[model samples]
Target chain A: MNAIIQTNELTKTVKGKTIVKNVNLIVKKGEIYGLLGPNGAGKTTIMKMLTGLIIPTSGEIMLFGKKLAETSKEGLKRVGSIIEYPIFYDHLTAMENLRIHCEYLGFYDKRAMIQALDMVQLKGIGDKKVKDFSLGMKQRLGIARAAITKPELIVLDEPTNGLDPIGIKDMRDLIRTLNKEYGITFLLSSHILGEIEQVADRIGVIRNGQLADEVSLSDIRRQRTDYIELLTSNVQRSAFLLEHELQVSNLKIVKDNRIRIYDAGISAGQISKLLISQDIEIEEIQKHTSTLEDYFYHQIQGGDKVD
Target chain B: MIKLIELEWRKLDRKKVFGEVIIYWVILMFLPVFFLKVVFADNPAVHFGESYGAAIDLMLPIQMGFLLFGASLINHVFIEEYKNKTMALSFGYPLSRKRLVMVKVLFIALAVFFCSLISFVLAGITTYGLDQALEVIDGSPSAADLMTYVVRMIIHSFATALASLIPLFLFGIWKRAVIPTVVCAIFLMQFPNFLGLLRITLNPDLFYAILSFLGVASVYLSVKLVNRLGDL
Candidate 1:
């Protein structure tokens, strides 16, 4: 029960083209798991498969400790999702749309409907048609609909898509509140690394239809490194001076001109002063911190095939 | 299953659907009288005005207009949902895709069948009232004629409901094209008239039976292949 969603070798192929390849993903209960990748990285496809919106070509999806298949979709009753984007009958009122969704889930609590609307700050607009709402309101209404049934798992794809900065922050806060106060597990997909970094407990980097890596934000934070990088014409002199004069043993000279110093005790000013005292020409120097953005970029564009 | 079918209606734009149905009803209600009092008034060869029993023949084909309504419902229930990506929302529900598709197919069938049936009753009353005023037909409807009209009304409406779904599997579900679906419904609604113009002699019951068979086949194929084709 700890893992609300477990997929084994989950693959999806459309017209002989593999969209998602052998994705073994596990989303634990009560954790906000973010799927991070560039556009066309199969993040939506994986979310679609996980939510039973689309069937995987070859894989096993274990949801809520039961096998998820076409016949055995009882797992979906406890799941709510917004795949790709929030879709509604635009001609219908927001309350009407939510009512239909609840009816489909066999949920018929009017108070819960009102509570979900109020929870998303969408109160007093339930009678308004979705077509009249702005994109931000629609996104919030989508979350309200998804969270209406108080499902155990809520999967949202790009929940902050097409929102203003304030709307995005509100969405992030609403997601956190739903996850923490309601004890709901979240599986969200976003191309925005900072958004994921802010909300997700763990992040899964998807590249070229495959999960390149899955790591916790805390682990990534722990692995975060700070180093001083310098651009100098004489790379050999900078390296020798830093090693002998400053005892900067952990260092690397990259691209024939840039030296990176990983010595925690030595500052950029100290390295620059040491190099200047040695009469070595110092072009430029700055302290650098490796962040999740760099980690995501490396996973996306660094090693794997990026088709 | 019934609840699922009802949900299909609840999910639709009720006002729009009602507007469409009213338009169909208003036009169809007076169409038979229009044909007798205007369209075929001078055409002595068209003996549909000769008797109530013969008039039933004209009414049967005229009410096939509901076949187009079936097409319209398919557009709303299936095609529009697919286009708007709302069908993906239904797919995410706990129900199987096949079951969901089955509900939609049944909803369309029931809507078309009842709408066509009510249309028959309305057209019957309108044409009769108009006939009372204008004496467009030769005599009043006999009990036999009334019974025959009622019987054919039930059977033909059922047939039209099924025939309307003929385009569902290929046009609605598979291709998801709007124009083609409506065009297919138009062709189906006018099929008998085309056969008449071509001087093709076919049994009416046999023809409806064939159309009903095709409609059932379409529903079967839609339910069977929905899981494969229902991906958004």
Candidate 2:
């Protein structure tokens, strides 16, 4: 795969505090790559640096196989982005706002304005002021603006924010269509792991301003294993008994009354019997699988200690 | 540069800025004409001179205030996008910052010029009516004097408009509209009296000349400030 965006030892600092530090990232063309992290994890900062909204403290960015600063106009011409909330002139109509954006791009296609509105399903809101739009509609309009020019690379920060379930689904579908239909590359930063999981071909997990891991969706799915969840009134007792008596070291207490066993060698039937014999009442026992959310939390928590 | 100007014009036009501006011009023009006819009817010569002076004097305040307003409007050329986090959308275009700023400034300058021209025309009509009324009652003033008065008023008003560019550029580059607006209001409101007092103590001609030089120098400094803002 051809790399569309690459960063080497990229860093940022604000007011004597490091926001992003020594981060390395790569995004290939025609792929929806997710940048997953919690709030204030420097996702927006990194996006700002890449888009040249903010100067980086150190390191470099390469876009379309050329240095980003070598020809900012050319590099940026291929990129479109929404770094945070969608903002527009409140008094202007949605179409008027998009028209302004088209003008800035020097794109004179008369049909593009309406076509963009159609893509976001906002075609009918003619002459209605943007201040009257709901948050979801505004978000959709933001996406429409970014995609209006049919840019080669689109960067969306928290694109699904303030969106309803249907809106999110529509946005995801639109993103997929853009990627598949036009071969456009996407760099998406989202805290909604499910949305990212549904759309991202690959994921880069950032924690505390550092890239923790980068893995393909297929690889993550293949490597992720299932575990047995056992919910009992006496979790501590069960964990102690399972570990000391049953010699099971892979048992983990997930909650006050829940323990998860990752060892495949231990049978639910044997664990149930052993718990019963130990006078512990097992309320629920079921197999649980790791998901994107699970993987995210695990990686973040695990990386915290090392940093 | 043309493309950027065209884009800003479209955006401003769509938002009814042009309509608002036209309304402002009409008011600036007609209000003086109406007020002069009513207030200065008794003494026609003083009427014509004061009317012309009022036309020029009115612009000093209006031009300064408009500079502040214009700054607020033009600062949005960048600040609004920054607030929206849409700077990337703009910077991602083929246009350079220099071109973008130049186009925006040109558009604003033209708008200011149009407003001033409309006001001047209205003042001219008022003077013509005053001249005819004076001719009917007393002896008519010579065409030469009328021409001179009109020409001087236009020149002074134009100079005031040009001087306002300093404050406009400063406020725009500062990106905080309120700060420059307040400072400009205070300075324009008080600086004349302050300078008058200084002239009484010193050589009045030299003092006025120095003030004029400072005004021009301030405008040049404003352009430099605007150029430096590109780095920001």
Top-lDDT candidate index = 1
Positional deviation of B12 in candidate 2, in angstroms?
A: 2.9
The number of residue pairs in model 1 that clash at the backbone is 0
For candidate 2, what is the DockQ-based docking class? acceptable
Native-referenced TM-scores of chain A, all candidate models? 0.93, 0.82
List per-prediction Cα lDDT, in the order shown: 0.91, 0.70
Question: Model 1: which docking level applies?
Answer: medium
Residues A1-307, model 1: lDDT tens digits: 4899999999999989999999999999999999999999999999998888888999899998899988988999999888777899999999999999999999999999999999888899999999999888888899999899999999999999999998898999989999989999999999999999999999989988999988999998888889889999999977887888888889988878898888889998888778788788888899999998888888887564221
Q: What is the TM-score of chain B in candidate 2?
A: 0.60
Residue-by-residue lDDT tens digits, candidate 2, A73-142: 5687788788777777666888888778776666767588788888999988946889899999999998
True contacts kept of 1: 0.91
TM-score of chain B of each: 0.98, 0.60
